[model samples]
Target: MTTQQLEVNFSELINKPKATLAGLAGAKRILLRRRDAEDLVITTAARVEQDAQVMSAGTRMFVALVRHDTAARSLLLEIIPEAFPWVRFLSEESVRAFAAELAEVLPAAESLGNMSAVATTIAAWQHTAEVHSDPELLAALTTDRGEDYGPVPEPGVTG
Candidate 1:
């Protein structure tokens, strides 16, 4: 399917909703750019559902191929570094582990119509590889400090 998206300032969406929506007549989606916050995508619920279905089908096809074909799995592992040069910072074992985890997460994320799981998995692995790439950071993180620190508070929560 062809994707047509138009970009407009977020203010245009808020101040001139009608004109902003008119842009959608020529494009399937509107990308609202926000200077101080994350950008947003505006599209019909039907378009969103169609995208989810396409993603689910494609993810399932890939999962099936990898499960049934050893060659496909090997090819995926072999191409990891090619696709993401940062993976080169990771050891072979870590790279394989990253691939395995990503493969496991992709289908589940797609089925849920949410890519957060897949994104989180990739970010975690990427952070691991980044740490591995730095000798000082890796040593500091891996070493035992032998000190009893206070209990850590939950992230994003304040006392």
Candidate 2:
């Protein structure tokens, strides 16, 4: 079981007036914002290595539009590898554990009510499967891993 990194950018998916960060604490799906002209949705998944780094962090094989809705408040959809299906690897227990974590992070609302369960199911599936190597995923995630969005030219700060 090797860890892999995956990521997607959907900046064009968001349409809301304001962007909000939201996620399913114990789940796999994390909603960024509602679909709009300027919105983007990026999803990255990886297997944790012994050093906690993604084994195939640089490779990205799966990408798609999980959702497109104006009424939806949060991004709704679980990311899965197109080449390797999750049902092949994860166990029931693993899924439950993952779901529990996601519930704590996801927003609390009627529209997001089912996210917990969905995240749990996805987690269960991922527990057993071997993720492929993806360089694209690694590059994207690593580049913005610790990026700062604050105003520049702060005192004592150097680029």
The best candidate in terms of lDDT? 1
Task: Give the candidate number with the greatest TM-score.
Answer: 1
Clashes of each: 0, 32
Question: TM-scores across all candidates?
Answer: 0.85, 0.19
Model 1: runs farther than 4 Å from truth? 1-3, 148-159
Give the per-residue lDDT digits (tens) of candidate 2, residues 32-68: 4344655343333451132222211211111112123
Candidate 1 residue 45 C-alpha distance from true site, Å = 1.9
RMSD of 1: 3.4
What is every candidate's alpha-carbon RMSD to the true fold?
3.4, 21.2
lDDT tens digits by residue: candidate 1, 1-159:
544999999999999999999887788999999999999999989988898888888899988898899999999999999877889999888888988888899998887778999989988988888998999999999999899887888998886
Worst 10 residues of 2 by lDDT: 58-67
Residue 96's C-alpha lDDT in candidate 1?
87
Flag regions of model 2 displaced more than 4 Å: 1-88, 108-128, 131-159
